[model samples]
Target chain A: MLDKTLIGRESESTLVEVERGAIRRLADAVGDANPVHTDEAAARSAGFASLAAPLTFPGVLAQNERFRHSLDLGTRSLLLGEASIEYGRPIVAGDRLTVKTKVADVQERAGTSGATDVLILETEGRGAEGEFVFRTRETYILRRG
Target chain B: MLLARQLYFEAVKVGDELPPLVKPPVDRSQVARFCGATGDYGPLHVDEPFARNAGFPSVLVPGMLAMGFLGELVTDWLRGARVRRFGARFVKIVWPGDVVTVRGRVADRRFEAGGRYAVDIEVWGENQRGELVVRGAVTAQLFYSGDDETRQRGGQPPLVVTPAEEEERLAKLSRSTAPARPAVGTRPAAAPAKVQPAKPAAVPQKGAPPVPVQAKVPPRPEPKPVAKPAPKAPVKKAPAKKAPAPKSVPKKAAPKTKAGKRR
Candidate 1:
């Protein structure tokens, strides 16, 4: 089981920025053909200052990949289970994002199989405006290695 | 917002493959453009001035770039299908000079769609280092020709494709909209020329900031001799052989042939 003391602990910040070609390429890959994603003119017509990808686009920025090491996965014994995201608004291109992930909960249980610790990580994706665009809840399970 | 209503049940099979994509490597220019378009000007992205003080040798690519890449991987392979749901963990940091590949294999098929097929697939990405960068799993609905009356209307697209029978439809559509891509792969995507400067995406805008002097661009390269049309691999330029930073606009056309065997 993970140390209960590790709960509510935060990891270093990782950031990322949005790129246009990649957005266009992603649009192409999905065959979305959405002008709002590829054509700046279409973007202006729709009211955005420039072409921006969908709200889910924020899922890409690591605050621009500033994260050098991850403390969560490096721990002595753990199993990454699942991850999910709930958004506030769309992440546009040119947006710089910073991610501050924290271990939110820790619980241990012993079943017929064995014993394990379920660790939940809460990551808040912030932009320059300090707006928290996304609040993600990720769960990890730690058992004897 | 509800971007697009995707596939129904009855169309997916266990072995279908989504269209494949090669994500361009991470580099300096890609970082700059991404920051510009998204308006994400966090100093960590482009401010080398501060990034140095904050602790790092240079700028890095965002994890969002990889997420966008995964979204594209699913959308492209469906060839017009919509991605109703998907998710991933940014397993590794992507940087310049690394080759990236994305592939999705149909994993299951469900029939909850009144008659349509709710196709499920697992998407994955890998880098030149043989590292798993992002793993995405998505569910989409496909049209198999007997299912619906609306499939003809581009079937309420994730972004309606106009469903032409041939690639020529898209080729013809390009004639009037986007400028013809000039370099293709012949001009090394990132290889910058010592004397001749290339076009920058920001040039069209008047008040754009002058490109930082420290920005490095790959040297302009000689074309490969292979005669075959370049593979569908994106024009992500190779950054080796040059210490220059990535330029703001290094978009190159598709190469004539596969650039040496991509790992």
Candidate 2:
């Protein structure tokens, strides 16, 4: 089994500034026709300060390499087994955010195909004002070597 | 505000089912668009031959894209329901022509701390062939409208969408937006541009931040045309002319594809 001591270990924090174009691209990418995600006026009408991010927009921030290496999952044949995100509030363009990730849990189990390591990663995002914005938990299945 | 109606916690029953959301079929453009938006160009999603080499018949949709679909499903259903928690696991690879259907039901409801009422939902997505592609649960806070206790506690109702209002909004939006997209693989004049050029990755070298200047000059778009010729196996006039760059890049950038093919 892979080293279990990595559990509770934290990765180097990553900081990202939310951009309007990035928000629009993400919305268009998903084929979501929601105007609030692409148009500032529509977002204002919807009671947001600017084009609010789609619920899953934070996934972009989670795509950093440090988090993957925190669990030493960079080289493993891994599949995203489960993902969960809890939002404290809507994210908007120009919101500078910081994400800190930690290896939450690890367990070994036998599946139909073979033995695997289920690695759980927990990421917490905070806005520029240092208030919590969202938290994401992703479970990756690592095929045992 | 955006929702014409407000969905109150009191009106939701534990067994209530949501209206099914059917998305346009997965297409190459959509896949390419997602890659540009998220900056995830994991070859398996965009490179057709690479995908086939990896044992998939064609390009596979990113698992996160399916989760995004489910997120859209929830927001469209609840109008403005605050998604407190959302999760899903991909069950199967979604291909280019699959029409995805998102189905869900209210699993449970409870009043949480701070006077927030939360609803637990069971959601699943299926393909045109009725194969399950993803399944998961979502927990959202449904504002309890018309509750004196909530109002006294300074709580406000969340926006909820009605079928009629949603239909009208979508119709109006559709008219204002560009024409509907054509079916996948039936190429239209507006196939999305080739996937964005690879950003000079930010790999730290010897604890020093790689200079950002190199990334400013975008890679040429011409590489796409050349790369397509070598992979298809049928349309080879002469391999010598087009064989230099694409072959080199694919061998280096997409080692997994090559390794998979070798196995």
Candidate 3:
């Protein structure tokens, strides 16, 4: 069972740089083929410094060390049931971001098989200039062993 | 050739449907490529054995992949429209061999601060079996040909300044460099402004960036381009903070868990 007390726990903010290569890889992975997210000149003409980060890019920041340690989900079967991200602006390559995540709620609900733990986590990302850039909310379902 | 056409708020109707973005059937190689691209090498996404051991029949496609399809659908229609906010909810598992099609409709339209307008689209994805796999909405700021020079900002339009004559435009711009809080999740105006039909002869050349289709509109009286210089100041702020980013890259290079590996 997930520790109920873990609710409301927050993690230390971690800083990450948005890399151009990483943005290109994400564009390729998604099969977007949008030049704005892959080619620098295309991005420049589109009004971005480097390649623009995909809409889902900020979710990767949740994998930071502080969030993992704070969740204390140790070896548990965790499934990413759902995720949603709200962007303040398009995140471009060469931008620095600070990510801080926290467990918003934890609850045990009865399932068809048995009891399951549902943890709601919210991650907020801010640009280096201290402006809110994006926020992602994810729901993780813990497998009942 | 199809991607070169620009979609403007003045031309699109509320019920107009966007062209569907259909993706090839998912496969293992594609999964591996996605993993390498996002740096999310989750065992469940890359290793069949790991996924089978975890009770899944085979490696599963990441939800983000479906989200990407939705992104492509909107941006393709938008052409150069700026995406201010996008949100999605993953509803089902998309496995290899499942072809996904993204569909969208112009849900709402509204006038915003600068001369630009906003288009709200309801977008979603489904598999070949017709199962709804993901649903979301997007708020994008796009330029219209009718916009006067006093408010030439394209994507990031300033907030709606309550008219008090001269105080209307200048006061809002001077108050905050930050964009007005995004009007997310809210429906734009019910009755849209007048929309003009697009010209048929505006087809663009192959592979070249799609030009905004609204370029064919008749020219109007020119006003001072006030919002033109706003974007440059914010672009310079990012590079200053970029110097320390490379130094921290090595520290975050590897996976935190045994099951999660960097490609």
Candidate 4:
């Protein structure tokens, strides 16, 4: 059984520097040919101060070690059920964001195969000035035998 | 194309379909590049042996990658519109050689508090076989062509507009619809200067309800995070204040019972 006590556990804050190259690489890997993601001049022309990260770019920040281990999954087979991100502002290259995560909830529900325990995690990224930038909520299903 | 063409708030309709983006076949190299880019080096996505042990014929594609595809679909269609929210639910595993096609439709649109127009989009990705692999939504804030000048000036539009202008804009928006008809009829026939202050009150009573109804469509996933924290706040405080004494007692008793069972 998944531990309900893991709810509310928080990860130590990690600092992530949003790099221009990283944004370009992710956009390329996803086959998005939007030039604003790769060219600073194009981004500026599009009214952005710098290269704007893709809408799902925060998914990378959520993969840090501290955030991943905040809730111990043990040896359970894990599958991502849902992922959601809400942005307060567009993340741009050269912005340093402080990222922190917390286990929001855990519940067991009947699954297509059998009973499954759902783990909900919420992560927030704040800019250097402590302004909210984005938040991502990920739901993981831990299958039980 | 860099900026392509700008999308305006007034030009979009609720049922408009976004041009679908069909990706080439998923190959190992592409998945590997995605893994390196995102730093999600999960073994299930890269190691064929590990994937077989986990009960899959081949390595599975990362759900985040599928989400990224959907994100591209929305951003490309919206052009320069600012994405306020993007989310997805993984319905089935995607594997190498599967072609994913992303599609979206304009689900709703409304004027937000900041004097910006926002649109809600329903987006999804399906395999070549037409099975849904991921489904999601995107909420983006769009700009009117004239709003560029407002932004360059660094000022927001006034919170309240004159009743006549408000009514005219609403009528223009709903000229083809039914609910807005009644609100248009309520427009005061008196001179604009005379009814300016008094009519402002009536406009909101008629116009405000529908805006909220439209706003409610996109916030379905928000209530869980908003409501979960409230109950947790008290639980956190209670544990800090009085939990240690009781919790320690259980800790002490638990080991004793374990030792008794061992004997």
Candidate 5:
């Protein structure tokens, strides 16, 4: 069973810098041949001041140690059931964001095989000027015997 | 840079389908690159021996990588549209050498209170065997043609569609042979160039902003091309088996679950 008391537990805040190389690497890995992600001139032509990050680039930020440790999952068997992101603004290269995470909810559901614990976590990123950049929500299924 | 035609809110219809993005087979190298990019170095994704020990035939592809593929499909289709929300539910494990195709359709359109126009899109990705790997939805904000910076602020009233009009539209769609739009995966003859630059729009500097840049259409590398035409028929029949009950469970947890049962 999941610790219901951890529902509102928050992680220590951390600073993350959006790097151009990281954006390009993700774009290339996904086979997205978009030049705007690599070329500043092309990005400026489209309207951005610098190279623009892909829509799902914030997934990298969610991997911060501070956020992961907050859950205290501790090497248990788990599977990602669902993942989502809500964007407050378009993130670009050279942007600095302060990120924090928290456990949103926990529930138990019975399946044919057995009962499972559903854990929902939310992480938010704010720009240097204190503007909202993005928020990511993930759902994990912990199977029990 | 060549300018591509922008997808304005006025041009979008209720039932339009996006051009399908068919990716090449998933390979270990690409999976490694993704692991390095996201810092998610799980053994189930990178270690073949460990994956086999975990009951998976081979290393599995990360769900975020598939989500990225779906994101590319939507952004590639809607030239200047800004994605407000994007999400997915993992239905099955995607194995190496499995070709993934991402597709989506416009489910609904509405005008918001802040003079914003938004569209709700239903998107999903499937493997070569016609099994759903990921299913999700996206909400995107768009601009009308000739929408200058001033009109983007709060001024225009909401555009409401009555129930009768909606019913009539659905009825007409059901009666048509091709429905309100063309079928999925059928590329139009006059489709825009794949690498065109995005058109410049009047963007607001603060608050929720417009999509500044658009991705060029995919020029995916085909290392080893499979029989391309074999999967199309199976894709249309995939939705009939939508329950995804036990088949969709991630294989990584199989070994541990059995161990727990033995105890």
Candidate 6:
């Protein structure tokens, strides 16, 4: 198997722009049905700059190479059952964020179904001001079939 | 007022909710700002006309943006350790002006190959309607408290090696390091403003250098560049931090539990 440590790494830092249309589009996909998510007029009335994204916008900030850790732990299967997030601050449109992320850890567990591998990655999205705009700990559970 | 709370491995237990991470509602201006700043101009992010044509109730939130909120939660809880492995799946869309709160609870703790206790973490995004659009999990390396007691005040403490001393140690080991490899081409073009004035294509590397992908050297508008400037126009890129090994290094075993390391 290829070395998991080699792939369980990060690339150079890149900057990302948060556009408004994306927030509304993602809202539509989730069926949020909230006027705040889609209605520009509604946002204007609510005292906002433009349409905003739901609070989960930061979930996709940090990503890794696929199957980067399959051979690291001794598990062939990883299954995901539940996920949750707690917002420190609301996500606004037009925010320039710098996300620094890294491979946090990898583990194996014995379950009723079988052995599973869990990979944890962390990311911090800082705005221009260096304030804590957003942060997240993303996870991947690769189950051994 | 915001007070900082550090979640140590010894004090953590499964099902314990780290303090609630509250995010205000999203707005159009901020959404567009997020689009510009994040560089994820998927039309669906800011193009309202295109969105209506595509058939949807309203514009949707970027999945990665919502995840960024989760990243903030981890930083506060872990007190600045790198979150090793993070992954999430987009189940639902989040729109502007919707209040999405981040919430997570410890799931389990187990030792990795090196006796390092890996904390299983799960997080999600909830809208005003309390709907969850995204879910994820993570493992964090933390500094525990026991070590603090031993090293309290003035004593031979762990992590006490001065930077100069560490530099000396690293210098001694540098003899075994390999030579620099040739640069690789192929960085995306639409670059940000450069931090300093320099040749459009070249960058000087210091210690632990970065990939050439980070060095395309965005062409600044001015011909005469400033000296020793910070990299200008940093877009919000989620590159993993720390040393990026190649595809052949051996996987690390569960780290051994030291006296007070909390990761």
Measured by lDDT, the strongest candidate is 4
lDDT per model, in order? Answer: 0.47, 0.61, 0.61, 0.66, 0.65, 0.46
- In lDDT terms, how accurate is model 6? 0.46
Query: Per-residue CA lDDT of candidate 3, range A1-145, in tens?
Result: 6888988888888788888888877777777788888888777666556787877787666665445555777655555666667777788998899988888889886554566688888999999889989888877667543
DockQ of each: 0.09, 0.33, 0.18, 0.30, 0.48, 0.04
Error of 4 at A7 (Å): 0.7
**Candidate 5 Cα deviation (angstroms), residue B141:** 0.9
Backbone clashes in model 6: 143
State the lDDT of candidate 2 residue by residue for B44-83, as single tens digits: 7788886556444667677788888877766655655567
**What TM-score does the predicted chain A of each candidate obtain versus native chain A?**
0.63, 0.91, 0.90, 0.93, 0.90, 0.73
> Judged by lDDT against the true structure, how good is candidate 5?
0.65
Model 3 ranges off by over 4 Å: B1-6, B112-116, B144-150, B153-263
> How big an interface RMSD has model 3?
9.8
- What level of docking quality does candidate 6 show? incorrect
After superposing candidate 4, which stretches have Cα over 4 Å from the reference? B1-4, B147-263
TM-score of each model, in listed order: 0.43, 0.66, 0.68, 0.73, 0.73, 0.40
Clashing pairs in 4: none
The docking category that best describes candidate 4 is acceptable
After superposition, the stretches of candidate 1 with alpha carbons farther than 4 Å from their true spots are: A1-36, A39-55, A58-145, B1-11, B39-44, B47-58, B143-146, B149-263
lDDT string for model 2 (A29-52, tens) is 887777778878877655567888
lDDT of 4 at A100: 90
Tell me the docking grade of candidate 3. incorrect
lDDT of 4 at B15: 57
Best by DockQ: 5
Q: Each candidate: fraction of true contacts kept?
A: 0.07, 0.57, 0.48, 0.66, 0.57, 0.04
Summing lDDT over every window of 10 consecutive residues in candidate 3 chain B, give the lowest-scoring window. B229-238
Model 1, residue B181: what's the lDDT?
28
lDDT of 3 by residue, B1-263 (tens): 32224455545556566666667676778788987776667667887887667666677788778888888877766766677777665555677766676667676666666554667777766555444556567778765532321245454444343235324444575577563322221222222211101111121222222221011112312332122211111111111110111011111111112221111
- The residue-level lDDT of candidate 6 at A133 comes to 64
